[model samples]
Target: MAAPARPYRIGTGAGFSSDRLGPALDLVRDGRLDCLVLECLGERTVAFAHRDKRADPAKGYNAHLEKRLKQLLPLCRAKGTRIITNMGAANPRAAALKTVEIARALGLTGLKVACIEGDDVSAIVPMSTPLYDEPGTLADVGLQLVGMNAYLGADAVLPALEAGADVVIGGRLADPSMFLAPLMHHFGWRADDAALAGAGTLVGHLMECGMQVTGGYFADPGVKEVDRLADCGFPIAEVAADGTAVITKLEAAGGCVTPATVKEQLLYEVHDPARYLTPDVTADFSRVRVEEIARDRVRVSQASGRERPASLKVTVGFDDGWHGEAGVSYAGPGAQGRGELAARIIEERIRKAHAVAADLRVDVIGASSLFATAGLKAQAAQDVRVHAAMRSRNREDIETLLWEVESLLCCGPAGGGGYRGAITPCVMTKSVLVPREKVRPTLEVMIA
Candidate 1:
């Protein structure tokens, strides 16, 4: 006989940080939640991973996530709760093996752990093509691609749960997968079940950001005396088989889950409400309804989702042209005047050298420099400081820009002497977008 259908309480833990583990485990133990979802990798995390991997090949997965998992995994297993996390980052297999080792060290054997991967973009991007579009090729604006992560949908995770994994982990999957997997497991929802898929998507969207859907992002006037924000609890979704969920937080936790908070999170980073795209399905956010409930809870219901496409979109990174910036500070009497003169001197020197800096930013600290010019009158600062930064598309241009700064110290105002330090050169990579069909998901089952 199949396991009985159970109402699942899904909680999304905060991003990869050691400090959040104790409280997250406490909520799981106290609330008896069915599943825990942890989101860790981001743009900054990807950059950090790339740098660390270059320094040491073994360093790929976020260490903080591993630390948290070590403490929570055994406790969760003891409490009969499953976990789905996207803490794998660039190395899902390695992460899975490490987790299994941790479980073994804890004297927990025969624990089923599943790893979902194949969302890498490193090999697909072409060497000739720029990561971002050049002028007239794709668009006038170009975005620098520090890291490209695939937004894999929940399908990859369902198989793991069906295979009887107590814990499932993935690398760079969409935020919603963490919540959707538990729903699929408890309800036995098929891949093409549009209504159930839509419901799961709604639940995932509502609680994906943890505290954001509760009271952390709320701007409601009815809320009062929200205390202990430092200890604010993350959001949880109690999902029923009928495709509806009650969004709430831990009991005795800070923050309030009002309709306003739900609405704010619904709109966060969403480009189009009617056609919010995900790997599993195209969710129609316009149909979502939020109702306030008693005691800091809200009902999220009536969302519609369309069928998912055959493949996923992949983000790839490659070598872009080199660029860097140099900056110096000026402070004291007549600092503003000296900084302005120094800027002019540097500009003249760059012009004389025939090097064009792609971008330049100048700031006069405390001078109210552009308030009047921008139609806001304000007092001019008595003692001001100035900071300037410049960027270019090539290393030679940057080197020339750095050389011009030293000349300003001698030719510009005497107060310019405050400027000091060696200008350093920074290199950035270009990234490309590819289709998911090009990347294959690697699956591994480990026995703990």
Candidate 2:
């Protein structure tokens, strides 16, 4: 494809489900973006939202949906920057309506909000879809199913853009597709152009994490120190029609965007470098090229891809069990030894009381916890904390296990203090594959 007359600027507003709101607002107010996207929601996040929908239908979408739209609608309207987001989680329709309400409340008339849906395949998933990793189909574990959603792609989002939507809301669309759709819509790129789509997808992946490509998670303190981390700005990609992109944050923005940061993000959460599968295309990152073309700017190009996958990856969430945890603090001399002894006491007490959980752990927070104690002894910490956790099939088992640890405050360790415990419902997740044709996503518009 020939290069466009001018590159399109896309700004990543939100990376995850609970990213900071102020930085995203900064992007809309000042980033000069053609499209602003919030790539919220993880694999199991929609499933959790599904359970929320079951309790109260209006509560499934992003909690800050109204507040965000109310604040940005007028600004985005004035800037002519379209907004795209996967904040819909399990309920895009509700999200669309909520946006309308916010717009009307702000007296912003003639605003078009589009809701993208049909990604939920929970009803049909139990028919024949088998787990991607483990054996057996969803029917075998139907009783345990909490929620199921198929990952949708860019094609599913194009119609909303075509509808002249001021804002687009999506439920469980792929993370990159929120940014990829605008690129496809603006450039008129064919869906099957694997290389072009791959390039765009690469840009989406890089920017999807918001500040990660701009040094949020890349900061390593002394080794990879960054500037003004508290005020770190989200990334913006200037994407050419050829699918090449230059990543950078706003001038005077607080984060680094060196080739080192960009390079690390390229491989984050990537399972297979050769076949990074997505609903839009199977991107090949093996031969991709990255270079620092300017200060705080990195150019990404030559991302090749093959044919798209026939099946969509489906994430299934179910009731894992119960998890109960409790913690205590040890201080002064011999704190580490006291912490270790407290952990052992909790484990032994649970075992003796027949409240031992199926899986149990005692962690010494200060010494020999993360690395595990397997070798020679080490010096005691000035202060140490002991945390114990247990997982079981029911709340009673977990609670029983936690109570044993909580009792340690008075009955077990000498310096045991600050006791705390809780029993919470735990959800497990598994992956499966469903035919691409089965999803059948749709886009519907709501105007205010």
Candidate 3:
């Protein structure tokens, strides 16, 4: 493949699983995007989908796959825009079949949907796969492991794109790799083109979250003010042959795209600006230039890259038993003291029971629910909500703790009201690295 003289335009559709479908339609209709990537998988989301797969072999893909395809496929096909997504979750073949169903229903023929798989390398991962942020390994993760998938890079999708697939459905690839695959395919970048891959990865990271680069989550009135936030737009990247891009949105869209918004998104979830690791390459955003070239147009250039990691990070999910939480509100004068006392009484009861005190967390919503720290400013308001959350390996422990919190309404606090309580099953995750050679990433295409 040869690099094109003209630039390529790529737009983001859905950022997360529940992203607005309307904004994606807006991009396909007007953004003039050569490709649109709809990212729908997160770390824990795929884990949950894995659990579904365990129950039934064919039920592991993204829940909104059919609806999203029904809404976007016909439009994308008509516009000659290649669509890519990680909605394959635990099952790419299943997702592709659903895409086929959608295409046939819409009377669209010869639509080629590619399903990229081989990211799930649980067989290669050792039983004692060590956790990145914890002391123990998967051995300590005593629950039933639903999924164990590697974060694949964009390299596998190249074959499908080269074979002229219109849509590529991937499972458990890195978030940025969704956009990186299209960029690499369009630019004909070599696997060894670390600089090019790095720049593309940077562009992918900036656009992966969809509207964050378009002012979706960067809003703070009177501080980081954003206009028309109710209908915020998604991001579009105008990529040059060199992999540098201008992050912008659809014309006359609700959200504004500027350098500030791009900067915020660039650093989101990035631990180190010098070495941002991804499946493709290690990106260096430290020396990148951010300039507002035009209204709602931010130019990000000079993103450097290093060699890809020798190993891929695999996220493993296990059943963590149950989580129980309940909250009760206290209003009027002396609400602060009452809320604190209620939280304390709930904690003491759980401690007196068999549940671990360290596994429990109590917060005063009107005081410091966020950050969950002791020194944060406690707002002096007439209303306060006391909340308690507990995790236990057994469901009974959480149920017992939640019962104590619910009891606060009738027996503990003077003005406690609005009692809410619930119990939920939680799937916990641990990160491990598997050798790149172990993951056999492949792309399979389905034609209609």
Candidate achieving the largest lDDT? 3
Q: Regarding TM-score, does 1 or 2 come out ahead? A: 2
Model 1 clash count equals 3
Question: Residue-wise lDDT of candidate 3 within 36-130, one digit each (tens)?
Answer: 99889988998888888888888788888888889899889879899988899998888898898889889889999998999988778887878
| Candidate 1 lDDT tens digits, 296-370 | 778888887887765565444322444444444567665666666666666666766665745655555565445
| Local distance difference test scores for all models | 0.69, 0.86, 0.87
Candidate 2 C-alpha lDDT tens digits along 276-356: 888989898888899999999899999978898999988888877888888889899888988889888878877876745
**Per-candidate total of colliding backbone pairs:** 3, 0, 0
RMSD of each candidate?
Answer: 5.2, 2.0, 2.2
